[model samples]
Target: MTTPPQPPERYTQLKAVGLLIGGISSFQIGATLAKGLFPLFGPSGMVGLRVCLAALILLTIWRPLPGQLNKKTLMLLLPYGLSIAVMNFCFYIALVRLPLGIVVALEFTGPLTLALTGSRRVLDLCWASFVILGLYLLLRPESAAHGNLHSLDPVGIAAALLSGCGWIVYILTGTRIGRTLPAGLATTLGMSTAGIILLPCLIPTLPLIATHPWQGGAALSVAVLSSAVPYILDMMAMRRLKPRDLGILLSMEPMLGAISGLLFLGENLSSARWVGVLCIVTASAGNVLTSPRNTHH
Candidate 1:
């Protein structure tokens, strides 16, 4: 026999859903804004600025006091921060070289793959098949005889793959760190560490600020939209939701990315890509609906 559920638990579940929706929505908008800034700052400069600004903003808010830590925790967090840095850095690089919708769609493979790997049920295979179908549609060659191959850049494709791996690492590491640290504090420290890692890159770009004020402004906007706001929302969401459920909810990112691109950047996808999106979305929704109800915090 199962024990009766508490009211607090029910409220937490509802809150988790609300936070997940809000966080994903904000992240999508942030990606669109970052895409808008791509031409001006380039990917590296944009990411560097965004991280630095987000670090500053978080520092102001959290004011985390650096204290002595066990070597184990330090080792754990170092890679976690590095993963965050590399994930965003590579994502921006890919963004500059590819369409926003396509880049996001490609990145979705990371979490989807992770989800499918953990399940043994035959139904999970259907989800995997849908993801594979989506990827084929997303990565199909745009050019033919001339060999221009304009649909997706080879380097960009590679970076997106790398970013996806980084995201997987981020998710796994986040789970580990969540056991010991509050989500907000862990996030603050991670972003700060990432910002520090990016300082060298930002130094060279400092001079460009004089030459390209608009670019600098655009980068700042990217920081606020992509890193600062979204991170806070994500912390709130993660606090309320379980890791698996969070993954299921975040799978909406690709769809939101596609919509944002269409509305903000006037980017269009072919019928096949739309079908791909539908398949991935359906698989993700199915996963969430079928999963157990326990929250993930």
Candidate 2:
């Protein structure tokens, strides 16, 4: 006979869920802080500080030697780090022109698509349709609140979509390392790789942050909330969650981002935008609720 989950295993799964929630919350908080820094450092400069300082902080903790990783492992890990660096650069740039919530909503498309791509269940398709419709309403040219859809910066929209693609790579590679190493230590190495990729971009921001202590302080905050807290927690959760379920769990991102934008950044969304958020919430939540027991990692 198959054994049922012991209390310990059940507790562990619950902890994983909590970590996922915490990670997502911290990530949005970090994004909000990063948004506020844009004026002082500009997008590229602020991203540079966030990525580089975060690398330094993580490295301080783990102090990984280069020789520890074989050539094959380095090959896999490098892409993950590079994706994170480029994604942050592109995302902050998109933030320059877009509302935080909208950017996050748009970025979800990549993962949502990935999650629903091969599902054979009718219920799954229903949620998939909701995602499609929600995105359409978000992008529709006419708005009930304003009588016209808010104009979007084409470049910003493109960058946000690109950010979604970056996240896919991040998830794939992060899952591999999460399975093989201590989450915290693996993150340090990953952040070091990201730091290397972002170093050239940081050159111009050094003087700006040095002169403006507030900007430097903000960078530190980003490192903690964005990279340290969320990345570590996510790695922990990934160790116990399926990638599809994890993708679905991340669907909460749009709602978290929208609320964060409204409260922290004074950004408002149209009715259609709100609907889009709701659809994603439903689809993602339903994905988790209705998923098979086997889907749970």
TM-score (C-alpha, index-matched) for candidate 2: 0.86
Q: Write the residue-wise lDDT of candidate 2 on 98-143 in tens digits.
A: 8888888888776667667789999999989998887776666654
Range of the 10 consecutive residues with the lowest summed lDDT in candidate 2: 141-150
lDDT per prediction? 0.78, 0.82
Question: What tens-digit string does per-residue lDDT give for candidate 1 at 1-297?
Answer: 977788879889788788777767777777778777667666787788888888888888877655634566677788788988988898888988877877887777776677677787877788878888888887887664456544768899899888989888988997888677777777777888888898876776789888989777767777777777777777787777776677667777788888888888888777787777777777776666665532434
Residue pairs of candidate 2 with colliding backbone atoms: none
Clashing residue pairs for model 1: 241-296, 242-296
Estimated TM-score for each candidate: 0.86, 0.86
What C-alpha lDDT does candidate 2 achieve relative to the native structure? 0.82
